[model samples]
Target: MVEDPLALWKALRNRYNHQRTVILPRARYEWTHLRIQDFKSVAEYNSALFRITSQMKLYGDTITEEDILEKTFSTFHASNVLLQQQYRAQGFTEYNQLISVILVAEQNNELLMKNHQS
Candidate 1:
């Protein structure tokens, strides 16, 4: 008699409401504590950001591009204050734009270091 699984799905969703109690706070904690400098690479930071934000979204949180960009800017390493200011001055409205630029910069820095080692 369960030809339509819609009712079953709804029941599952409602029954699992307690999951939000567990997941939402954990997601928020991870999000707040996330710092780009903690990761070894831009890609790793990006991956973790998406994962945390997606979890927050699942729990009815709105994670906007501006929020993401601001979070990234604010969490940069303290030693890179000038670099952070420069990136912030770029006025990146989208997270992807800023991240792409940072990724390219990281690659260029690595290349420069390799050249220096030669």
Candidate 2:
């Protein structure tokens, strides 16, 4: 066990860098194929995004937020055309803002359905 936190972090980062060199190609391919419309709900999509981003950051070296968003948006499936249009039309420059819009839309849709049910 390393007594120094910084040293431990450095050691872990070095190990990750070694693994990343071997694994990044497969990881990048998988990320490219991941599409927003493949998920049935915002929550599911968000969870998958979180998982991918966290793994990429931890083992695939540091990626910029813009790069992540670009990779994510690159895979937007046909079913998400409307959402894609919204994104383009609104010109959202940040990834988090796009996530917020999707989540809020999901919540609104759920509330509308519940209201109709009542």
Candidate 3:
């Protein structure tokens, strides 16, 4: 029972450090294989990106917003080259910024599709 928060955090970190041996290789593999087009939806891809990156970070890998942004833009569908370029031009500083735009665009596209079907 550590009364100090910092000490408690350190204790927890030490206790779980051994899991790093098992987790790092798997996390790295997932990170390498992750691609946007593999997912059926933006949300699904976003969730996976975070999950893998969080694991990597837990094991001391440094993941930046630029890394995530480039990974996403590079994996955009071939037909979406212009769209990818447009997003890059926007210069989003964070993953959430880009994801929010994507989610909104997807939602708006769905609404347009529903209207077209009616």
Per-model TM-score, in order, reads 0.88, 0.66, 0.82
> Which model, 1 or 2, shows the larger lDDT?
1
Residue pairs whose backbone atoms clash in candidate 2: none
RMSD of each: 1.9, 4.1, 3.4
C-alpha lDDT of all candidate models, in order: 0.95, 0.75, 0.92
> Per-residue alpha-carbon lDDT of model 1 for 1-118, expressed as tens digits?
4456998888888989789999999999999899999999999999999999999999899999999999999999999999999999999999999999999999999999999999
Q: How many residue pairs clash in each candidate?
A: 0, 0, 0
Best by TM-score: 1
Model 1: CA > 4 A from native: 1-7
Q: Itemize residue pairs with steric clashes in candidate 3.
A: none
Weakest 10 consecutive residues, lDDT, candidate 1? 1-10
lDDT for residue 105 in candidate 1, whole number 0-100:
98
Off by over 4 Å in 2: 1-26
Instruction: Give per-residue CA lDDT, model 2, range 25-109, as digits (tens).
Output: 6666667677777888877877877776676777745767787677566667877677777776887778888888878988999
Rank the models by lDDT, top first: 1, 3, 2
Q: Ten residues in a row with the worst lDDT in model 2?
A: 21-30
lDDT (10s digit) by residue, model 3, range 1-118: 8999999999999998789999989999998888898998899999999999999998899999999998998998898899999999999989899999999998899999999999
After best superposition, candidate 2 residue 55: deviation in angstroms?
1.9
